[model samples]
Target: MTSPDQPNPEAVSDETLFGADVADYARYRPGLPDAAIHLLAATQHGVPDPVLLDLGTGTGQVPRALLPVLRRLVHIDLVDVHQHMLEAARAALEPVRGSCTVSAFTGEAHTFTPAMPGLAPTLITSCRSFHWMSRPRVLAMADRVAAPHAVVAIMGDGSLWTHEADWTATLRRLIQTYLGDDRRAGTRGTYAGPGRPYEDDLADSAFSDVSEHCFPVARAWTPEDVLGYLRTTSFARPALFADRYREFEAEALGLLKAHARGGVLKEDAEFTVLLARRPGGAA
Candidate 1:
């Protein structure tokens, strides 16, 4: 392990950050809580024909969750830096696409523009992903392509690393034992989160009119589920462990089992959604 004075490892290029974890991610990462999903649909109410631009759309969770309830949604554009993620997103959303057009773009969210120009979206979303982007640049792009009444919804509940429970605390300690004390991030670096809250970022951006919502969610996990979720995390993914990932997995499973109560581990999470709109009386 590097000394405290040592610099953090250089991060992998953003495009490749989550590429290797797609399968486990698709299989195990929790979807947006249903309350949040319904609220997102309501955000588009009264719009003539709503369309969606889901930035950093990991496996298209935002769209997949909204499609069933947001029936009038006419189109969806899924953008991500990783093509692997976009591919999996496409597969997951196809059966539910209905008459709406679903398109995937493999590129940075800040640089994405519609293949069909002049088609502004009524709803824009980024879930658990805005931090991985050039935040100001993305909001600027969203400004150029959004309908005046469109809402930019940034949503996330903190991951397992932030969850506070006796079991999760134990799990974090075990992870630190294998990795390091500083949070491991992506493939090559430690996580240094945004300096200020996302609220501060929005306050300075085009979408200065903002509101926040929180949905309390309760989730239960099995030891196997915990292992599968760990495989998709930047901190504990198999690559981070090198040759010892199998050992880590075995040990992690045992540790989790010992902590489980009646075959379950619990998470009490609050999912937060920040809805931003242009600073005007459009709505």
Candidate 2:
């Protein structure tokens, strides 16, 4: 039975959930030095080597990218709602084992409580993962869980293909050429994309005494890379489709190849990062 307030699990599977596509997400995905890095730079003025907490850390990209830059950070707590996503993050961070200590766990954002002793962190960040959380619940958790000077940065509401024209038309044309117009309700629109707007509830609220900014990042994707990425999308899964899977795949590849620059499709993706600091704790 579906509850009025809760997400419909039957309508969505964890494999197809927000945590999916984490493997190729960091590899083929563009827009690094994303909102999280910007937030770290802003609050890093006086803080040296402060403990870091990464919420909704998919494939450990944010921490892995930011680890080299922090002056004095020793440990990172990577939290996620899905165990599999955390596992992927663990694997990605293994090559850089000596850089920083990492503790990964699976738990709901609302009920999550750090078990680490004396673990009040100086920085807490979420990259492209904040939208799944309920705003009020997350705010309450932030208020209680963070150290006084903790910085919370949530990045989302950014688009991967940000062409000025109706890119949706291009996307639809590609999908139709492959799938032949037989679309599932879940896979029909922009909602099926890997990116989404963050926290519709907090859409109206602005952070006080916190600086928020958006940075533009671009990446060039070959036909193969784009296909690999699209395959990671929720709609591209086997279970999600009733038929025409390979036909769709081939067509998608062919369509993008037609428009690819130098036989590559360059996607313009943008990420919105939210950086907020608690009053008085650590620098």
Candidate 3:
């Protein structure tokens, strides 16, 4: 639904830009976060030797997975606007000892550049983080730093409900149990809260012009995993709420118990990969 001309409002905040739920995020969503390594495996050559750059690289996940494959993963510059996230990435990457050149910096996606000084990257990868970028600016930036024959791969949750079919019902029961007094507001609304909404591409813009593909990845969780996943979510943070999260967690757990089959919640979800190349850049 987003257009090239409209700036996605969600691009502005630093939700977990700080180191808030980084550990939880790394735990539950480890699969998707680590999926960037495989992205390079899908290159035209079927195995890539391209110079890489990772935008919004959280906890150094991409670099950790990719360093082994590339001939020389030179000048890996990870840019994140959050200082805390960068700190976590630094810590995670510090133990790495190899020929790869790794560096972390604090900057927005648009301001990020390869560390190789005037070099354009042959491959660029972003995972589950582009929904927060300004569409027009990002596409223009991609067109700039991406080498003539470069490839960019972007992954996102095309449909969060792709897995959790009955989240609404679960949510309803949870609200009824936790907020016993006023069930309506707690269930239908305020789960994700106002500005922090969970959906995809409010505007269908130039970036959507790329060749797109989707595949189902792992999306199974017990009540505990679900709780861990929520802790990593932008919505589940204490700063975003007026009330203590215990009430919210109790309500959420109630919903899961009410709708869960055999006390477990399963959802059909997949990862969407959008691979684009500059028209004349590569064959």
Candidate 4:
């Protein structure tokens, strides 16, 4: 499901749509569950020093979370269209990358080529950013770069705007009052849902053998935390509100405070990962 904050796939460039919020995103966006990383690493069990290709690797959250666990992971190719996001990801991964070599590529995911020779990825990951890409094209490109047993993992969870909670409803209503009924993605237009399921797209791609996994996550947010998270999202980005941005913040803070129990808000969400591989492979 598309949220008010999710960018319209047709409206703008990836950098313009997401780069403006890079700092906030790096600070507030949730990391992948440890169990999910374990599941991803388990797929590459016997492979010695496997390579990882992470598409749409915003701030390198997936790599940062997976590097500590996947001792066999030897190299990582972080691909993104935004230079700032690529730099942020490189910085985040460098300090912790013990035996692994991390490299960043500033370009669209579908067209990215690995910088290192003979680098066929054993595991390819896209977290919370696959929706921005052309699935078939990316899968075709992956086919050219992936090893025989490579697994393509697509993972995401709903955003704060899509979460069902009393405080969220109230906050959404306030946004609607100011931004109108339509969910404003940027200055250009509103969001349109991806018409079909991602599974359907993957089913039609080269990576047709698919398996799914889900992790239940419980989160606690302070009023300040919620505000900080909003700053990272497309719907409530400060630049989108312009002159009324501070006004919206004041009212939103008041609403959050009214609903908070000891300045804390609670949410229950499910993080899902879909792992796909070529038919007859051991993904």
Q: What lDDT does each candidate get?
A: 0.84, 0.60, 0.57, 0.83
TM-score of each: 0.93, 0.77, 0.73, 0.92
Counting only residues 3 or more apart in sequence or on different chains, how many pairs clash (N, Cα, C under 3 Å) in candidate 3?
13
Query: What is the C-alpha local distance difference test score of candidate 2?
Result: 0.60
Two-way TM-score contest, 1 vs 2, winner: 1
Choose 1 or 3, whichever is better by lDDT: 1
Candidate 2 residues 46-65, lDDT tens each? 76557777777767777777
**Candidate 2 regions off by >4 Å?**
1-13, 18-22, 34-39, 97-99, 160-168, 176-207, 279-283
lDDT of 4 by residue, 1-283 (tens): 1011122233324565678867888888888888998998898899887899999898889989888888778889888877778778887877888867777776778877777758789999999878778788999999999999899999999788888999898899898888888777764478665568889989998899999999999888998888988887767778778899999999999999999998899988999999999999984
- lDDT, residue 205, model 4: 89
lDDT-wise, the better of 3 and 4 is: 4
lDDT of 1 by residue, 1-283 (tens): 1011111133223544567868889888998988899988998888878989999898889999999999888888888877778788888887887887777666778887786455589899999988888899999999899888889999999889989889989989999998889899965599888778999889998899999999998899999998998877777878888899899889989999999999999899999999998888355
Instruction: Give the Å shift of residue 132 in candidate 3.
Output: 0.9
* TM value for model 1: 0.93
- Measured by lDDT, the strongest candidate is 1
Q: Which residue pairs collide in model 4, if any?
A: 5-235
Q: Rank by lDDT, highest first.
A: 1, 4, 2, 3
RMSD of each: 7.4, 6.7, 7.7, 5.7
